[model samples]
Target: MTHVAIIGGGPGGYEAALVAAQLGAQVTLVDSDGIGGSAVLTDCVPSKTLIATAEVMADLEVADELGITVHDAEGDVAKRTTVDLGKVNRRVLSLARAQSHDIAERLDRDGIRRVAGRGRLDGTRSVVATLDDGSEERIEADTVLVATGAAPRTLPTAQPDGERILTWEQVYDLEERPEHLIVVGSGVTGAEFAGAYNALGLEVTLVSSRDRVLPGEDPDAAEVLEEVFKRRGMTVLGKSRMASVTRDGDRVTVALEDGREVVGSHCLLALGSVPNTADMGLEEAGVTLGKGGFIEVDRVSRTSVQGVYAAGDCTGVFMLASVAAMQGRIAMWHALGDAVSPLDLSIVSSNVFTAPEIATVGCSQKAVDEGEIEVEQVMLPLATNARAKMQGVQEGFVKMFCRPGTGIVVGGVVVAPRASELIHALSIAVAEKLTVDDLALTFTVYPSMSGSVAEAARRLHHVR
Candidate 1:
């Protein structure tokens, strides 16, 4: 049996371990930060769980619109609801820990050896793990999968004190919500947190270095979100680069490069991420390191060295946990002599867990604009959908892109509540190369937000 060694315990590492073990390979997973890595332990799971609570808060805000009144202890109608930060944080951490425990249990059931340590490549086919007890163990493997994930990037001029200023992972430790929260960076992380805090009834100021929030996403979707944010009284500082963040007593201030400063009760830096690839002996083992210190891997997850692979954030590919899991599985299939398909990023679906979430799959608008791919497009407003109207959702839309000649769905985007779930059918269409007509003919439940997806496809079908 092939012996597989996976370093790091994130989605990429754990997922690969399971596939390797199931394929009759002896698998050993070495991790220092528990079995779920940052995803389950701190980043993805914790953040999303917190967002779930924030989502409920947002729903309650519209209860009156739905003719639902919340009564207080005195039998008077309550004008607003309040959040208990301590309780919310406890629930978030609890859910994250529960998920990590479950993942560990699954790995144990699969008979995959779990080593508690920091692992590094000793050579092309060897892993040396330094345990917490100051002992070391060496494992011989036929294949090595490196899935060390990433951490939040910090700037020298604006450092996190872990008190008034915090990283995305550190936010869960807050026992009190800020009166005015200033979020630096306008990427997915920044946007999601700003939106969540705003929904939770906290005053928020979003500092964006770019002209718009979520510059990497669809412009139309970003525009809609920005409009909603501004409408809801979020102070969006567009085209404003943060020079530094300093805390004076209880007040934290963010200084912009343009000589303007914004003060808040707390600050969050969501600039980007830095891969955890230092001192791993990767280059010594003939695994090439690319720009920003990310591991260089091919479509099948192989590094430059034979029998060595890298996946997930360390590879600098799409940072989504789903993509990381897929890369890990692909690496195992290839290493174990099983049939394997290279990673196709275009079909990977991703969602930004903000209010009126933005989800997308396949080719993006930038590609079309750059003449990289020609396609027909149709966008339908969700406001026209019966269910959206019933739910009092006035924002969001569904947009579809298809080949002009063949009508094959190439890409699609959804902007609505639970857009993440709504993008699955479109993801399947893009993955299977299904035509717009095929999507249009598929049965959809009436009075549903998903109906907008079919409607958009139907319009695209007619355009071709």
Candidate 2:
């Protein structure tokens, strides 16, 4: 029987542990944090939960435009706007903790041993874990999986005290709503948080080093988001990089690279993530690391060392939970000598949980624009969409990319509420290698947001 030791309890580690255990491998999971890792307990779940409240706030704000009115308890016009940050924080933390406990319970039920500690590899086949009680336990394993996830990268100038200048994960602990939020970095995380906080009635300023928001996403999508943010009364400072963040009594000031300054109640550093690959004896084991400090892994999730593997954010392969889970499963399958296929990123769908969520899969406009891929593209505005018009949604678009010759649907992007759910169909099509003709023939309900998706695919049918 193979004994497997999995490091980190994030999506990658837990998923791999489950698969290995089911494959009859004795698995021991070592985690310094909670069972669900940062993705569940801190970053992804908490932020999305907070965004849920922000979404409700956004809907209420738009109710007046939708010919809807609410009366207060006294039967007068509803003129009050308030946010119970305490309640919101309570609910968010409660949900996160519940989910974490559920995961831990499931792992225990599956017969996988969970060790609460920081783990380090002593050798190729041995792991040493320092327990919470200051005791160290060494375990021998036939295989070791390093899923140690990443953390938010902080700047020397803009340090996170975890109170005022915070990381994305730390903001969930706030008892009071920020009067103004200055989010540094205009990447996906930064943009999403900025949009969410703006929806929640905080004066938001998105400081970006680039000329536009979402610098790495589709240009068209970024353009649309920038426009929407402006319309929503957000202050977007382009080409404005954060030099440092300083707190003065109650107010926090962000000094920009260009000498311009902005003040806010709190500042968030959404700069980027650094892989948790340090002090793990990876160097001694001869496991290679990439230039960016992530583990060097192939599609099969194998590091350079024998009987060892790595996955998730540590592998630097998209840093998404879904992708991490897939990679973990694949690693287990391969290690157990079962039927295994290499990781395929082509059809993997991802989403930014912003106000108008950005969900996408397969090829992108940047790829097409750079002539990296030969594809025909079609972009359809949600304002013209029947369901969108009826729902008073004026900002969003569904864009599709197809093979120019065969009209095979290669990729797509959806920017609107619940786009995350809607993109699954597109993901299936891309993964199944279905053509635009196939998508056009598929039935989508009329007077629905998804109708725009079908129509966008249908329009790509004529590009040949």
Candidate 3:
């Protein structure tokens, strides 16, 4: 059997290990962080879980409007809804650890040998893993996969002290809610945390270097989220670049380049992340390093060296867990001689778990505006949807793109509550190259949020 040695235990690493094992290859998984990687143990899972709790709190704020209210023993309607942050955080961490353990069990069942240590490429065909006990283990392999994930990016001017000033990972350790939260960055991570805290009834300030929040996402969706943030009494500082973040006692202060200052009880830095690829012997083993020290790999996850592959955040290709997993599987299939298709990012669906989550798949407006592709587009407001009206969701819309002539659906964007779930059908249509008529004719439950998707698709027919 072909021996495969994989490094890093994140989605990319663990997923690849499972694939190699199932392919009848002797797989050795070298992991340092737990089995599910940062995506499970720290990043994706934990943040989303926290957001889920925050969403419940947000919904409670509108409970009275829906004729739902808590009655006290004195027969008075109770207006207080408070979250025990300590309890919520404990639950988040518990769920993450449980998932990591489940992945470990699955790997063991697949008969993959796991080394709980830090691993690096010794060469194209071998790996040297340093165990936790200061012992080194060398493993020979027919193929090697590097899936070392990434760490939260920190700037010299803005350092996380893990207390009053914190990183996203450190927030869950807090036992009490902050009186005021100042989130720096205004990207997906920043917007998400800021929105969640605001929904939880805390004073939130979002610092954005750009004119609007979510500068990298769909502009329309960003506008909706920004408006909601403002409507909920959250302060959004636009065009303000963070100069320095300093903490003196319990107070955290952010100094902006424009000579402005913002103070809060706590600060969360969401400045993005850096790949954990340094001092890993990748370049020494002839692996090419790209901008920001990420491993340079192609669609098939092949590095510069033969028999060597890289996937996930270390590859700097999307830095999303789902994409990382797909890259890992593609790498294994190609390495093990299984019929393999290269990674197609266009059809890859993504979601930002802010209130009224933003989810999109396939083509984008930037592509259309730049004249890269010719396609007709349609957008429908969610407010017009019967379910959205009944649910009292006033913000968000469904937008779609399709070829004008062929009428084949190419892309879609959904900005609504659970847009993540609503985008799955659009993802399938884009992946299968289905026509707009396919979605328009697809049966959807009446008075549902998903009906907006069909309505959007049907409008695309008229646009063509």
Candidate 4:
């Protein structure tokens, strides 16, 4: 039987370990942290769990806007509601830890051995794991999968103290709610947390070096998010680059490059992530790294060295958990000599988890702007939808892009509550290369938010 060693117990490593084990390989999974990786134990799952509670708070706050009467503690009429932060944080952390434990259990049941320690490569086929008890073990493997993943990037000027200044991962340890949350980035993670905290009744200020929030996303989506954030009382400081962060007593302050200062109870740096590829013997094994220290891998997740492969965040792919999972599966199938297909990013749908979440797939407006793809487009506002009006959703839209002659959907965007789930239909359409007419012809339930998606597709039929 072939022996396989997978490093980092996140989605990529754990998923590949299971697949390799099922393929009759003896698998050993090594992780310095808990299973489920950063995505589960810290980032994606925990953040989204927190957002769920914030979403509920948003609904409660909007009751007054919907012309529904709300009562205050003294039994007087109230407009907006307050949030219990401690309760929300507890729920978020509880779910995250439970998920981590469950994944570890599943791996153990699969007969995969788990080594809790830092794992490094001695060679292409030899893995050296330093255990928590300070012992070391060398395991020989025919195939090695590297899924070491990434961590939140910190700068020398604004390093997190894990107290006042915080990374996204460190925010869960917060017991008391932030009086004012000064978020220092306008990327997806920053935007999501900013929106969530704003909805949860915190004084929120989102600092953006770009013109608006979600600068990396579709322009239309970004514009809508900015408008919504402003409407919700979030002070968006645009075109403002942060120079440094400092703390005074209990309050924190962010110094801007333009000589302005913003202060808050706490600050979160959602700058970006750096791949965990250093000192892992990647160079010794002849595995190459890209310009940014990302493991250089092909579509099949093969590294430069033979019998060595890498996947997930470490490979510097799209950096989504879904993409990571797909990459892991592809790696296993390719390495095991099974029927395998190369990674297809064309139809890989992605979403930014914010209030009125943004979801998109395929050809983007940026691609079109750069003269990379020729396409027709249509955009429709959700405010006009019957269901949206009833639900008091006044912000958001659905947009579609398609080839002019073929009418096949190349890409699309959905901006609304639960856009993450609504984007799946569009994802399917893009994946199947279905035309606008095909989507328009499909039946959508009336008085539903999804009907707006079909209407957007229908508008493409009348485009000039």
TM-scores of the candidates in the order shown: 0.97, 0.96, 0.97, 0.96
Which one wins on lDDT? 1
Mind sharing the TM-score for model 1?
0.97
**Residue-level lDDT tens digits of model 4 in 29-119:** 9999899999998999999999998888677655766887776666433243566677778898899999999999999999999999999
Q: How far is candidate 1 from the true structure (C-alpha RMSD, Å)?
A: 2.0
> For all the candidates, what are their Cα RMSDs to the real structure?
2.0, 2.2, 2.1, 2.0
Which of 1 and 3 is the better model by lDDT? 1
Question: Across residues 69-137, which tens digit of lDDT does each residue of candidate 3 receive?
Answer: 754556333245667889999999999999999999999999999999999888778899999999999
Scored by CA lDDT, what does every candidate get? 0.93, 0.89, 0.92, 0.90
Candidate 3 scores a C-alpha RMSD against the true structure in Å of 2.1
Which stretches in model 1 have alpha-carbon errors above 4 Å? 70-79, 462-464
Worst 10 residues of 1 by lDDT: 71-80
Model 2 agreement with the true structure over 1-464: per-residue lDDT tens digits: 99999999999999999999999999999999898899899888898998999888777756767887754666333246677788888999999999999999999999999999999888798999999999999989988999998999998998899899999988888999888999999999999899888887788999999999998887887888899899888999999988899998779999998899999999999999999999988888889998778999999999999889998999898899888888888989999998998999998999988878889999988888888999888888898888887777868999988887888789999999899999998999899888887888889898899988888888877544
